[model samples]
Every structure is written in C-alpha cells, then in structure tokens.
Target: MDAKEKPETTSSMPQRRPDCIKCFDALWFCYSPFHQMQNYYRYGEFDNCFGKWGDLVDCLALKTKRAAEAEEILIAREKAKPHIWTFRTVDEASENWWRMYKHLVLMSPPLPGAAQPPPRSDKS
Candidate 1:
C-alpha cells in the first residue's frame, strides 16, 4: 500500500441481518409446558405453575414475532404467484383468520399492504 492510496478490499460479502438465534434455540424448551408441569407441580410446587405459564406465553410471543418477520420475506418471494381474491368457503376463511390472529398477535399495527376481503355489497 502506497501513501495517499487506499488499500483494495477483497471481500464483497453482504452483511447479514441480525437474527435472534439464542431466542429461537431456547424457544424449543421454553414453549414446552410438559416438563415444567411434570417437574414442578408433581413435586407439589403449585406456585411455580402460574409463573411458568406466564413465561411460556412470553416465549410464544417472541417466537411469533420472529415468524411474522420471516413470513414477510416468504410472501415477497412468492409474489409472482397469482393472487386470489376470496376464500371458497367460510370454514377455510375462519381457519386461516384464526392462524393469522395467533401469529400476528404481537405484531403491532399489522403488516402493510396485507390483503383484505372484498367489501360485501347487498343487492337488496
């Protein structure tokens, strides 16, 4: 390298987004209430059960937040697919709505540009 000359950079590696790896890894254990209930309540520790339930809810919320973020990326990648306007039946719509509600509970303000059902028009 000469004076007044910048050194050439070799790596053009793109920076990766910071994923909460530890959170994802620990979620497998944290979300399982079976172990906690078996070990704690079985030993007559009733108070711990309530606390454990709270902990589990928090963990689930964290997992959902991460999943919603990943879902956005997947949706973008699948944009080339034809977009359907309505559900074929009420049962299918209800099921999908329930799933979305659970997954996006912690996702504040909801996702932008999300698809909405067409407004119903009364012919009467």
Candidate 2:
C-alpha cells in the first residue's frame, strides 16, 4: 500500500493478552453471564459483560498484590520501630500512626480492588 494510503494507526492499540495462569483463570471465572450480571448489580455495567468481567478480575489481582505489599510494609515498619527514632511530639506520632493504620485498613482483604486468593499450590 502507498504510504499516503496506509491505514492510520493510533497509539491506543489493544493490549496483548496476559500470560499468567492465575489471570487467565480469573478471567475464565468472570466470563459467565450469570456471574457478570450479579456483579453488574453489585457493581455496575451490563452490555459489555465479558469485558467488564475481565477488567474486574484484573483489578482484583492487582489489589491483592498491593494489599500483600502493604502488609509487608507494615510488618517491616513494626519490626524497625524500636531502632527507628520517632517524633518527640505526641501529635506527630499520633498523626503518623493514624495514617499507617488507615493504610493497613484499606489494604485488608475484601477491600475494593482486592483480588480473590489464588488457588493453593498443593491442590491437585
């Protein structure tokens, strides 16, 4: 085809398919209309069933990962608390404490974007 006649391509090309088995499994679980419709009522959207499910699954997976990361950070902070010097002022520590607590609460399981737990590796 002539350069002038070549099809115009945009930067918003579709993404490549995910290779992770967990992601695929999550996607499969989301494909059914029964599930999608229930989720639609619980969440939102209707017409784009499969796409919506895929998006939900992906979001869940990311949320799970982030939650896990946040938990680890919390643990590390707790472990280092003794050695780490804190603010001498009560208000400073109180503010920091509340911020950390809020983050932990937000990271807890079932939080929005929290992914369903992956299947146990021991299961056959």
Candidate 3:
C-alpha cells in the first residue's frame, strides 16, 4: 500500500514546544536595534542625518546593556538553585521575566513630541 494510504505508524509528534521565554527574550533583545534603525531610516524626519545615526547607536547600546543584564540575572538564578524541586519553576520564571524585559525593550519608546511639552514662552 502507498505510505499515504496506510494507517500512520509513527508515534504522534509531541506538542509544539511553547516559546522558550529565554529564547524569546534573547531574540527580542537582538531585534530591537535593527528595528529601530529600520524605522528611523524609513521615516527620515529628524533635523539632521547625524542625529538619526546617533539615535541608532544609542538604541544599539541600550539593547546590548539589556542583554548583559539579562545574562547576569540568568547566571544568578542558576547559581542560587541548589535543590531540584524548585529548579524548574525558578528557571521558567526567570525565562519569562527576561522575555518580558526583552519585549519591553523592543517596544519603541514614546515619540519625542508625545513625551515633551511644547517650548514655553520667555514672556511668561
């Protein structure tokens, strides 16, 4: 019989793995700089080209700092867990926290105009 026609013989595949929070965090952390750069390059509204470049550099530095901090937290968590019973939960929480942190980092900050009040008049 054709393989297609025969009953499935192989064991059913396992459930698709949930996104590993740690992996997701790392992915977001890595993606932020590129995303910010793309947005800035595409929009091109800044007063000077150099300012945009500076923003890009700043964004990259921010992402790098975040990644380093996350790594430190992960290392600390691993070191603190001597017993196995709590290991799985602690690891999962750490991964989720890191992932959420990454997500926050990837999110674009409020537009400058949105955050800043209009320039005040000297007469006041």
Ranking according to lDDT, highest score first: 2, 1, 3
Instruction: Give all TM-scores, in the order shown.
Output: 0.19, 0.24, 0.19
lDDT of each: 0.55, 0.59, 0.52
RMSD of 3: 18.8
Over 1-124, each residue of candidate 3 has an lDDT whose tens digit, in order, gives: 8767977645574322223454445445445766557656888632334544554554454455555464565566668978766545764675556556755544767665543322344743
The lowest-lDDT stretch of 10 consecutive residues in candidate 3 is 13-22
**Candidate 3: residue 67 Cα off by (Å):** 30
**How many clashes does each candidate structure show, in the order listed?**
0, 1, 0
Q: What range of 10 consecutive residues in model 2 has the weakest lDDT sum? A: 11-20
List where candidate 3 sits over 4 angstroms from the true fold: 1-11, 21-31, 43-124
Which pairs, if any, clash in model 1?
none
The C-alpha stretches of model 1 lying farther than 4 A from their native spots are: 1-45, 67-124
Model 1 scores worst on lDDT over the 10 consecutive residues at 14-23
lDDT of 3 at 17: 23
